[model samples]
Target: MSSDDPKGIAPPLVELPISTADRGFYDGFSRQVTIPAKIIVTLIILWAIFFPVSANETLSAANSTIISSFAGWYVYLVAALIAICAILAIFPQTGSLRIGYAGEKPEFSRLSWFAMLFGAGIGIGLLTYSTGEPLSHFSENPDIIRGAVQAQSWDAVRPAFVYTFLHWGFAAWGTYALVGLAIGYVAYRRDLPLTIRSALVPLFGKTMSGFGGHVVDVVAVVATILGVAVTMGLGVEQFVVGLSRVGLGDWLLNPDGSSSLPAIALALAILVGASTLSALSGVGKGIKWLSNLNLGLSFLLLLLFAIMGAGLFALKLLGQGIADYIGHFIPLSLTLFSDEGPVGEQLVAWQLDWSVFYWAWWIAFSPFVGMFIARISRGRTIREYIFGVVLVPSLVCFIWMTLLGGTAIALELNGSAGGTIVNATMADQLYATLAVILDPGTAFAVSGMIVVLLMTYLVTSTDSAILIVNTINGAGDTEGEHRKHILFWGAALAAVVGSMLVLGGIEAIRITMIIGALPFSFVVALMAISIVKAICYDLIRKHQGVPTTAVGVAADKK
Candidate 1:
C-alpha cells in the first residue's frame, strides 16, 4: 500500500492504468468506450433504417417466443440475487461499511439526493405503468373472475396491487442498490474508474484493465442505450396519447385513433432536445431542478388522484397492498410454472407477460440507474444506502401505485367508467381513468398535468442516462462530459425511438430491450458476486490485522 493510505484501509489489488488513446472520431470522445459503442449504435441505426420491417419482425419473434420461454429463469434468478443484496445490507457485519471512507460526510443533501436518484431510477416507468398496470391486472388477474363486475372483488383487487407492488418494490430497487454499492465503493473508496468493470477489480485485479474490461464497459454502454431508448419510446408514446386526449391536435391522432408516428417523432424531438440542454447544464442545476420538479409533480398527481377518485378505498388498498406484498413476498418472488395444469398454465403466461418482462427491463436499465445513484451516493454507509435506495423509493412507488391504481380499480368496482378505462389501450388507460373519475374539465386539466409530469421525468431519465453513458466512455469521468458527446447520445437515442415507432412501436422497443438485457443478466449475477467478494475482502483484512497493501494482504493469505 502507498504511504498515504488511511488507517484500516488497503490498496486495490491492481492499479487501473490511465488511457492515452487519440480522440479522433469525435473531437473529445474517448476511443475506448465511445468509439466501439458508437460504431455498434451506428450499425444498428443503419439496419433499422434500411430494413426496418425485417428488423422489427426478427426482434418481435425473438422476444415473444424464444426470450419469453426462458424468462422464468431470468426472473427467478434476478429476484434471488436482489434478495441477497437486501439480506447483506441488514446483516450486521457488512451493513455499517461506508461507501466512501469512514467519517466522510455525504456530498449532496438528503432531499436532493433522494430526488435525483428516485427521478432517474423509475420516472418514465411509473408514469407509464402507475395506472395501466393496476387496471390491466384488475382485468387479467387470474385470481378472480374475469367479468367487469366480478373482477372488483377482494380476490382481484388484492392481487392487482400485490403484483404491482412486487414489480416496483424491493427486488427492483434492490438491483440498483446492489450495483450502486459495488460501483460506489470502488469509485469512491478504492479510487478506481466508475465503470462497471471497476466493480470487479477486487475479484480480477489487473486483468480488469484489458480486453475483459473493455467488453464489460461496451456491454454496459449498449445496454444503457437500448434500455433508455425503450423507456423513451414508452414515455413519448404516452405523451402523444396524453396530447391527443388533451385536444392538442387532431393530426396527432392516427387514422385508427391511436398516436401517430409524426406525433411520436415530435415528442421525441422535444424530449431529446430538452434532455440535451439539461445534460449540458450538468447535474447540479438542470438535473437537480428537474428531479425536484418531478418529485413535486408526482406528489401533486398522486394527491389529485386520491382526492378526485376513491379516497377511502385507496387508503384501504394501501394498507392491504402493503400487507399482501409482505405476505407473499417470498413465495410470489420465487414462484415459477410450466405448462401443465390450468392454474400452472395461467401462471406461466402471466409470468411471461408481466413479471418476467419487468425483471428483464429493470435488469437492462440497472447499469444506467445504478451508476447514476452511485455518483450521487458518495459518503453513505451500506446500511444507509440500502435503506434510501431500496426502501424509500419503494415506499413511494407503493403509495403511487396504490393510489393511482387503486383509484382505477375502485372506479371500476363502483361502475363509473371503470370498464371503459380497462378497455382502452394500455397507453391511454391513465387518461381514460382520470376522465371517468373526474369531471370533464378536471380530467382535461389533469391530462395536462400528466403530460408535464411525463416531460420532466422523460428529460430527467434521458439526461441522466446520457451522462452515465458518457461517464462510462470517459472511464468514469463524471465532470468531463463533452457537449458533442451529450448531443450525439441524445440524437442517437431519439433516432432509435423514432425508428422503432415507425416499425412496430412498443413491441419493437421491447424486443430490442430484451436482446440487450440478456447479456447483462449474466453481468448482474457477476456483480452480485463481486460485491460479496469485496465485502468479504474488507472484513477479512480488518479481522486478520493484515497490512494496508490490498495486494499484499491477498498475497499473505495465499
Candidate 2:
C-alpha cells in the first residue's frame, strides 16, 4: 500500500539532454564542462607532483607481453586482410560494399570531408609510426616479439604496408561507415536518435524500451572511453618524445617516460582543459578549426621531408615501395597464410601483432570518429557517406605513408641518414630519424612542430572522445552535455592512462589495447551482419512491391 501510494517519489526516466537549457540537464551528461576541465587539471598536477624516475623489471615485462600480443594478432596477417576489404569497399559496383547511405550522395565536397575525417582519425598514428612501421616490417629484426629474426628483409615491407593498409583500410573504415550509415540512415530517414542503440533498432524493436537496450548503450560508452584513453596515452608519450628530440630539454624522456608522470599529467591537464573548451564550442567551431590546422601542418611537414630529406634516396626507395605495394597488394591482402599452412604462420603472427590489434583499436576508436562524423555528415546521402568515410581517408593515408615512410626507408638504405633513423623502432625511430635527415637546428625545429602538432591532435582526440562518451551517457544528445560529465571522462582518461604508463609505459598500453580490441572485433562483426540484413530487408520490401519508405520508417520505430 505504501509502495503504491508513495509520496514525493521521483518518476523513473530514461535520458537527459546534454544541452545547457534542457529540463533534463546533467543526468548522465554534464553541461558546459568547466568542472570536468578542472578534474583533468587536478590529475595533471598530481601526476607532475609524483613523477617516477625509472621503470621496474615488472614494468618492462608488461611492455614486452603487451607488444608481443599485438604482434600475434595484428602484425601482418590482419593488416593484409583489412586492406583487401577496404579495396572492396571502395568499388561501387561490388554491391557488397553498399552502405546505409546507399540511396543518396555525399553533401560536402569530397576533399574537405576526407581531410577532416583522416585528420581526426588516422592522423595520430601517422605522426609517430608512418615511416618507422614500413621499414621495421621490412627488416628481419622488426620487433616480432618471440621470433628471432634480425632484420625486416626487403620482403617484409610489402606485407607490412599491405597489412597496414588492411587494418586502416576498408575493414576499419567500414566499421565506422557502417555505424554512421545506420544512425545516419535512421536519423536522416527514420528520425531515430543518433546513438549506437539506434543502429540496433531493427533487432530489438520496442523491446529496446527496457534494460537490454540500456546495456547495449552502456557497452558502447565503456568501449569509447577505453579506446580514446589508450590513444591519448600514446599521443602523450609521442608528444613527449618529439618535444625532447626538438629540445624541450632533459625532462621529456627522463630515460623513463612514465617516471615523470606528474609532469606528464600536468601537461595533459592543460591539454584536456583546452580540448574540453573546444568540445564545448561544438564540432564546427573547435574540432573543425583544429583539424584544418593539422592539415596545414601536415602539408608543410610532407613538403619539408620530401625536399630536404635527400631527394634521390627517397625517390628510389619510394619507387621500390610502390612496386612492393602494388605487386603484393592482392597476395598480401588475401594472405591468411597461417602457421598451419604452406604459406607459413609468419604472416599469421604478423596479423596477431598488427591487424587484429588495429581492428580492435579502430572499433574502440569508432564512437569518437562516428560521433564526429555524425556531426559533419548531416546533409549528405548514403553513397556520399560511404565514399567519404572509407575512400577519401584511405587515399590520404596512402599518400602520406608514401612520402614520409618512403623517405625514411630511402635514407636508411642509401646510408644518407646513415641508417640511423629506420634502424630504430617505435618512438626511437621518429626521434633518431629526424636527427639523421635534418640539421640539428632544422631537425629540432621540425621535430618540435611535430610535438605541437601531436599535442593539438592528442588534445583534440581526447576532447572529442570525452564529448562522445558524454554524448552516449546522455543518450545521444547532439546539442552538447554536462560540463561535469566531460571532466569525469577527462580525469578518468588521465588516470587510466597514467596507471598504465606507471605500470609499463607504451608497451603496457599497447598490450591493453590489443586485449581491449579483441572482444570488440566480434561487436563490429555483428554490426556488419546487422547492416547486411538491413540492406537485404530494404531489397526484400522493394521486391515485394511494398512501400520501401514505409518499411524503413517501420523498421526504425521498431
Per lDDT, the best of the predicted structures is 1
* TM values, all candidates: 0.93, 0.78
Candidate 2, 323: how far from true, in Å? 5.8
lDDT of 2 at 366: 74
Off by over 4 Å in 2: 1-25, 28-108, 141-160, 256-259, 310-349, 423-425, 542-558
For model 1 the local lDDT of residue 406 reads: 82
Question: How many residue pairs clash (N, CA or C atoms closer than 3 angstroms) in each of the candidate models, in the order given?
Answer: 0, 56
Deviation of model 2 at 254, angstroms: 3.0
| lDDT per residue as tens, model 2, 53-168 | 33244335644465455444443433433443344345543343223333444455655666667656767788766776676665632234334433544444445565455455
Query: Whole-model lDDT for model 1 versus the true structure?
Result: 0.82
TM-score of 2: 0.78
How many clashing pairs in candidate 1?
Answer: 0
